[model samples]
Target chain A: MIDYDALLNTASTMGLRMLESGAEAYRVEDSLQRLCRAYGADSCEIFAIPSLLIVSLCDPEGHSHTRVRRLYRRGTNLWQVDQLNSLCRAVCQGTPPFPEVDGSLARLAEAKGYSPLLQLAGFAFVAAFFTLLFKGTAADALCSLVAGAVIFFAKYPMERHRANSFFVNGACSFLAALTAIAGVRLGVGQNLDKIIIGAFMGLVPGVAITNFMRDVLEGDLFAGITKLTESLLTATALALGAGIALSLLGGAA
Target chain B: MMEIFTGLLLPCFYAVMACVAFCLVLNHHGKLMVVSSLGGGVGWAACLLCAFTGSDIVQYFAGAVAVAAYAEVMARLMKAPATGFLVVGILPFVPGGGIYYTMEYCLSGDTELFLTTGIHTFGVAGAVAVGILLVSSITRLLREGRAPKNRHLGGEK
Candidate 1:
């Protein structure tokens, strides 16, 4: 018999890990998989709400890809006996441990999914784009890009989760953008064209744009809108950076 | 001439490294990295090939196709989602900078140049999309047709 309390706690830990990892959408699914295994429950499927509540409430301005799937076990699979109802009972009530269960459960948890790092990379790319547009100088744009890249690279050494890593990434972006602008104004030739081009070098809308169109084609208006909104916000941030920097300079002059 | 090559090389390298890093971070196996890199390389190579040949349309379509193929193959082998690989792998080939510049033109109040650049950007995006769709649809059709054979070969009950 599985200790229900212990199982839930473990599941919650897995959930926290996923959230910290910037898992976008697959976090809940992966967590549920772990929880089901721990409880010796047969098959379980996790349905993540399409609304950004899961990710945004935790870390606003963070981007996550969302996914939904159905999981089931075939014949002779240790956990296949209990379906959704039984699994719910196990989670809510104490279910006896099934000693016959395989060791795959622990293996699943240890499987590294660099969820948070990916999100940080995406954020840094967007920040770099914005810095270039706003600074309107090649040196400033390059500095911002380098700064963002360095912050992202630092994630390898820090070993922190997504939220903290992104906070660092955002700080680096702001600093890089500010520094670049200051440096350019000091004497460097302000090359607007190169700055704009370099900033956008990292902020390609490949995933969002493709997914938005795919969702629309698949007749998923809700999903499409969600993706579209996320993409627009990132783009707006890029535009805002450039617009603000230019306006500030104009005002000063 | 060398300036253009240098310009193209940096972006291509960045695109390939980003795709590989994404795969590695996802904890996908070494096989996935190899396949994705190969695909990305092929796509970028197509771009350079196009530049040499001076055929923009062919270059764009070929690059998109190569990437789509790479993504499909990797997804099937890794049993993971293909979206991330496809999106990041083909990013270098996209005309995002062109679109940004077009918008900039309009923002700076150069409407005529903005219109021209905007149209050109859209044209590039449309061509790329078509190439992607073509490759994806073909791969899907082939997979569907071979599903029974695959199942049989795998000895599925």
Candidate 2:
């Protein structure tokens, strides 16, 4: 007597998790279908978009179920994808009872992030090293570090309030630009161009752009175009934020 | 000779460190971070190779091919999403700097520099896409013949 509710829950939840963790739409569809099959379900079908996921499963006994989830927050956390990947392995070995699957997902959903301090440092190092890669001087890396810290730490409070993506990124890039320009104005870095470019790395649409590329190539044309436009706008917001500072600074000096 | 060696070595080193940091920021754990760093290093190494000898287009395409191929291999070995590796692995060639420089020129009203760099930037971006497409297409081809059905690259079945 396969518990259809449990099956539906697990299948849809896994799809949702994959979608939220920045997977391509086709991958999301494929994983959900496979997971359902592994669970003794006859079929699972998924229609995944950047903003919504719809899944339908038919159990071996010919029972059918459907779930539609409207996604509110889409983020990129590869860790979640890795966790789900392992969970699938466990299920295939012996279809875990629903509770075990449920427990693993709960833990995964609530997995603790690395400390704020460490992530802030990670941001700083990313900016600094990339500056060095771009042939910026040591002083430019130092300036990038400072600017990175400003942008990275500033994101916490902005996210706490659950602000809009464009506004949050726009505002943070604004801060990033101001900090880098100030560093240059104070003789902390030699090249404003290099420093600002390095500082902007943290805000670049890495996940979006990568996923969009994968999506387009994977034949998810609609999803690919959607993500492509979004990534482009995100890049635009970043440039806009930094542009304001540059424009103002240029006007001043 | 020494200058060329250092020129290549330093960028690769920074790329490795930067990829690790990028992974850490995205919350990748233990072995995944190391593997991703190696992948990024390979991609950056390819980029440097392109810079030294190849045309602008092929170099960009080659770097992307390196990234996509490495990410595909690593994902198969690790049972993780190739996207995880692809996202960070391709960072070395991402057009962040191009975007910034384009905007800078636009703002400064330097139409000449803006158009030239903008076209180049767009070309590099396309080259990266072609790289990912070529490798992913290969992976899909390899996965399609055997492997039962529809289970390739992170399906984990």
Candidate 3:
């Protein structure tokens, strides 16, 4: 006897995890439907947006079960998304037992990624090299490197508290701008524009913009629009923050 | 040779390094990280290679197309979703500085510069989107046409 409720729950959980880890809406919906079909559902209906997922399937006995999951936090952890994606494919292919599937999901949720130190190095590397790529002097890259570290340290704590993303982005850019300005004033960096741009690149909405286009092209207009608004708002927040810093310092370059 | 080295190879190197570091920030590891960062280099090179067009939008479009095609091929070979490669690979063309400058112009009351910069920024974004969409749609169509069968219709007991 197949447990319909558990099946719906498992499938919905998989979709929820994918969405929370920044999977595209259509991919989440497809994965949910596939998981259900793999578990003996005649057919399944799955609807997924950025923050919500709903999956419903009718058991062989004609009783329908539906599972709805609301995602509270969303971040780009491609590792998690990739792992969950592989897990979904494997389960669909082999029709794994329920316990094994549940165990894998639980383990993945607790999996650790890069260490904080390595991630900090990542932030610094991107900021420094991007400064160079944008024609900034070597000193400017060094300044942005420090500013990048500041943004990371400032943003990390807020992220842990689940603060509003807009506020976090704004604060990070504000801090980065101020740091860049100070670096220039102290003669440690040249070209304020280059340093500011490089420092804030870490906070830019590359993923959001990419997803906005992809979701739109994939016919998930609602999700696409949501991401477009998200990227736009993030850009606004960054500009507003940096503008405030520049105006306060009387250095509008 | 010096012009080619400075114009092409150096920038591509910077893009690839930045993308590799970015992969760390996104917590992507292993061979996928190395492969995806190469896509970034490919994108930047394509963008530079199209400089003769004298239009940023067309250059970005070409770069995005190259990245999307690279991502599709890598996704197939690696058995991973293309999103990983696509997202990381396209970063070099995302126009972060443009967004900053546009906002600065708007804030400083330079309405004319703001308008032009803002429009250009959106144009670059739209070009990239269209490029990715074209490649993805064509690939999907080709794959579906080739298969034309539902391989996982029912549960395997």
Candidate 4:
């Protein structure tokens, strides 16, 4: 006999994982429904927004089970999304047993991303190259590189403590602008605007904006609005932080 | 020649590097990193190639279409979700600079420039979104046409 309870648990867990990793709302809803149906669910209904997921399904015996997951933390971990996508595809195709599905999900969750040092390097390269793209001089790129490193190191701990995203972005951009201004003051960089813009790219809501469009296009109006708000708030935070820094230290430079 | 190199080639090269860096930040691993970063290059190149249109909004739109189409094809080949490619590829076209300038104008008390820049920023963002919408909609239609059985159900109203 199919274990409907275990099936519900696994399906909901997968959905939660995908949502946390920033899968588009439609993808999350579609995946959950597909998984439940693959396991012989007679009917499945999934409601997903950026901040919550509700999944309900009925077994052949007419018993209904529902799982509600309140999501407080959302991040763009595309690797996790890709891993879960493949796992979902495999399970649906092979009709995998419950134990196997549970184990795979556990393993995938524990998978590590790049190490801290590498992530730091990633931050630096992103800042530096974007400066060049914006027509900053070589010295400005170097300054933005240092500013990016500062932003990463400064923001990492607050993020670890689960600080409010807006405050974190604001504080990071404040630091970025401060660094850029100091770089100009010290004669290490030219073009203050270019340096700050490069540093800001690290904090920009590019992923949020991209996902926002996709979500809206997929007809997930609620999720789309949530993402749009997130992107807007993030941009505001960055600007506020940078604006304060520029006003304070900008005069000295 | 200098214009071609600086205006066209250099930005695309920077786009590739920046995207690879972004892949690392987002924890995208394996050969997918390089493949997806190439999409960023394709996007910026498309943007530059369309420069004759004399409108930044149109440039962003062209770039988004190229990136979306590339992401779709690559997702099929790699058996991975297209989100990774789409997110990273479109980064070059995102209005990070526009946002900065808009905020800058607001902070500096240039309401006139602020309004214009902010509206232009929104226009650019809308163009990118519509371009993505257009391509993905067509791809979905073609996919459903080929495989009616695979059409998604139960989610839409």
Candidate No. with top DockQ: 4
Q: RMSDs, each prediction?
A: 11.5, 2.9, 3.4, 1.9
List model 1 lDDT by residue over B1-157, tens digit each.
8876555665465556545544443343455555665566668767666776676767777888778777878767765445545665666556655655665666677999988887876677667767776776676567666442212211131
lDDT of 1 by residue, A170-250 (tens): 343333344445545665436544444444445445555555544443344555576657555544444444445544564
Per-residue lDDT tens digits for candidate 2, residues A11-107, read: 7788788788877898788777777777777666778998889888777667678889888888777788888877877776788898888888888
Question: Candidate 3: which stretches are off by over 4 Å?
Answer: B146-157
Give the per-residue lDDT of model 2 (tens digit) for B76-146. 99888888889888887888888888888889999999998888878888888889988998898788765
- How would you order the candidates by lDDT, starting with the best? 4, 3, 2, 1
Candidate 2, position B119, lDDT: 87
Fraction of native Cα contacts kept in each candidate? 0.14, 0.68, 0.66, 0.70
TM accuracy, model 3: 0.96
lDDT of 3 at B95: 84
Candidates, ranked, TM-score: 4, 3, 2, 1
Calculate DockQ per candidate and list them: 0.17, 0.53, 0.48, 0.65
Q: What is the C-alpha lDDT profile of model 4 across B1-120, one tens digit per residue?
A: 999898988999999999999888899998889999999999999998998999999999999999999999999999998889999999877887888888788878999999999999
**Candidate with better TM-score, 2 vs 4:** 4
Better of 2 and 4 by DockQ: 4
- Find the 10 residues in a row with the least total lDDT in model 4 chain A: A244-253
